[model samples]
Target chain A: MPNPTAAMLVIGDEILSGRTRDANMHHLAGRLTEHGIDLKEVRVVADDPRAIQEAVKALAGAYDHLFTSGGIGPTHDDITAENVAAAFGLPIGVRDDARAILEAHYEKQGLEINEARLRMARVPEGATLIDNPVSGAPGFTLENVHVMAGVPKIFEAMVEGLLPTLTGGQPVVSQTLRVERGEGDIAGPLGALAERYDALSFGSYPFIVNGRFGVNVVIRGQDEAEVTRAMQDLEKAFPA
Target chain B: MPNPTAAMLVIGDEILSGRTRDANMHHLAGRLTEHGIDLKEVRVVADDPRAIQEAVKALAGAYDHLFTSGGIGPTHDDITAENVAAAFGLPIGVRDDARAILEAHYEKQGLEINEARLRMARVPEGATLIDNPVSGAPGFTLENVHVMAGVPKIFEAMVEGLLPTLTGGQPVVSQTLRVERGEGDIAGPLGALAERYDALSFGSYPFIVNGRFGVNVVIRGQDEAEVTRAMQDLEKAFPA
Candidate 1:
């Protein structure tokens, strides 16, 4: 069976503005690959409601699963939950279950559950809460879209809880050979090798490190042995 | 006048597979910001031709300028120029100007201009070349879409050549205040402040640094005085 495809929507002005380097996309990509879900595309947009709503609808409709990070905190900029709810035309308000989670945690810490803090409890109707082990605020899943926090620690914890519940296909395995030659020098032979191993996908990434130009040719496939065989072929084609 | 909006299409499987963290997006964002262009959205798609074609069409139509990085190399995996040409239904092949540039560069280094090396000379019909000072392989601009290399050094060089040619509006000015308090505590007052200065944009980013919870309130606007005024309001609202 084909692997379930996933798309990630990262909503934050800070990321688009270059104020923050996104850590969630890389973290999620690695996790999804390990879990046998193919992460097809990723989008980073500003924290605008219209942009978020549009991206949510498009990605949710296109992929098997849509994972979103950021803009789920307790601030005016935290408009992702409401925008996501609006995308599906679902009514959203403070849910008792989510409220209880936040209330109990704040009470234990002797902190007041203020209005802004309570905003974290406002989840869309018919959504299931994804537990946040790092922080008390709970992320939620509405349909196939999983909403998580922007904070790396909390986002990772949410992903850990969420992945086990979803079904996945065979994990993709990859093997890479570093060819210490310009891609142009290797492209011809590499192209022929790629055609022979049609089941595996080949990616040539050029890099310039310490004034040396080289290309890292990576072969990826679900079958481990096939990936290894292709890597061997590639190694032979571009002899060290 | 409002800043010209731009979108970036990052084409690479390495980024999607979590093998490489994308440096181009952050670099482009800062440069565009400095040049008074708003980078509204960024999409990272895999090396699939269909994905690249679709994204190129969408971003090119939606934004004032579309910038693409990756896949413009001399390998079978390097299909960006062709996909981009296909997106616009334009014919593509090795252009004389581009071929001449690569031929001269390789000749100077006493290297043969082989068939794979000649692939770098492919250019979409009606596109103008963007100079690559780091490498001889020239990037091109087809309509508003600027195609550049994925390597950071080359990408930066291409951006430097391209930015001066494009018209930009007023550069966005920003001021930030760090509140060593949770976002929940500051969201209420910050929301009120954001409302008062509707022209400026307010962003509340929560962080956990050294195990201490804090939020950074950033106010951004094209008007420097307005941004400063909003920052002051944010400071007064969340007194240290």
Candidate 2:
């Protein structure tokens, strides 16, 4: 099977405002990787409907799966559901199934579900609900777009519930070798090694550790033996 | 004026692969806030030219300023200059001024200015060069799109060089009050305070410290006195 490509759309002005350091992206990245889904792109847009629609359409068309976070709240800024509906050209209303889920969820908590909270039941038409175990609001999957909550806990729960249903490929395994050397000095050898191991992806991340330059050489691939061989060759080329 | 809206496009597959935890977004967010520029969006794209072009055109048109990082190196995957040029419908080539800068830089380093190395000198037509003190490879300013380096050190240097040249509004000042309370408990009062201060932006960040729920109430505005007053009010409302 071809690579399972994925894209993430993070919808919230709060993230861009630096008010919130998003944990969902990291969570999804790791999970998707383990599921053999290569997350190709990540776009963090505001709560604007047009922006959301444009991003949803563009990303959903390009990638095999599109994961969206945020803007599924009670406030006016919560426009992802409506915009996503428009993107897929689907009519949106209070989904009976989602309503049932939310009602049951609230009933268990003995909480009064008012109009403000009931707004969470609204979902795009003909969409399968992605269960939110932590929150009452149900995320929906429409044409490969998985819309989840902005809150990390809720988003995580939704992902956990959703992942088991999807088909996945052999997960990419990776190992890192830390070298106490500058990137410029190691760039030539690293480039050659990357060219040799065309199947595996290699990355050289440079960092300063206590005023000393160091590079972390990462080797990633689906084949564990091939990745190990490449790592061995890399170690031989640049012995610690 | 008009909140000085801006957007950031991070062009790299490394970030999505979790090869690197991003420092650019946080640094840029802080800088933009200090410059009174409200960053409305942030997109992380792969090294694909089409993705780069699409994101640049959309964001540049929507925002007052658009900042891009990565995909402008000497490597084959570094197509940011060409993509950015395509976004603006401008021809990309090695400009004389940029070539001169690179030539001088190379001469000082006693390095050969090959076709591969000269790739760094290529800039979109009708663009101004951004100074890079840390690295010889200079970033460029094309219209409102600020093409910056991927390396954190170089990116930060470019930002420092560019910040003073741009027309900045009154710096946004922020005051944070850490209260020993859960967000649910403080949500009501925080919402009221947010309404009371129409000129300011307010947000509640909730975190757990030592198994206790704690909330940090942030009040941000241009007026120092007003922000101080708000902080004083918060202190009075929730003493210590």
* Predicted model with the maximum TM-score: 1
What is the alpha-carbon RMSD of candidate 2 to the true structure?
4.1
The residue-by-residue lDDT of candidate 1 on B1-240, one tens digit each, is 788999999999988888888899999998898899999999999899899999999999999999999999998888899999999999999999999999898888788899998989999999999999887999999999999999999999999999999999898888889999888888888898888889989989899998678988889889898787777777777788
List, residue by residue over A1-240, the lDDT tens digit for candidate 1. Answer: 999999999999988888888899999999999999999999999888899999999999999999999988998889999999999999999999999999998888788999999999999999999998777999999999999999999999999999999999999899889989988889899999899989998988898999778988889999999898888877778789
TM-score of chain B of each: 0.98, 0.96
Candidate 2 stretches greater than 4 Å from native: A103-110, B72-79, B82-126, B170-240
Residue A55 lDDT (model 2)? 90
Q: Chain B, model 1, TM-score against the native? A: 0.98
Tell me model 1's lDDT, rounded to 2 decimals: 0.92
Candidate 2 lDDT: 0.82
Specify the poorest-scoring 10-residue window by lDDT in model 1 chain B.
B228-237
- Which stretch of 10 consecutive residues in model 2 chain B shows the poorest summed lDDT? B182-191
Which digits, one per residue and each the tens of the lDDT, describe model 2 over residues A21-99? 7778878988888888899999888667888998999999999999999878654446788899999899999978888
Can you write out model 2's per-residue Cα lDDT over B1-240, one digit (the tens) per residue?
Answer: 566789999987678876666778878988888888888889998777788988899899988999998866665446789999999899989888888887787687666677666778899889999997765778999999999988888799999999899887777788889999644445555666768888977755555566455667778788899999988887888887
TM-scores of all candidate predictions against the true structure:
0.98, 0.81
Question: Residue B9 in candidate 1 has what lDDT?
Answer: 97
Each prediction's Cα RMSD?
1.0, 4.1
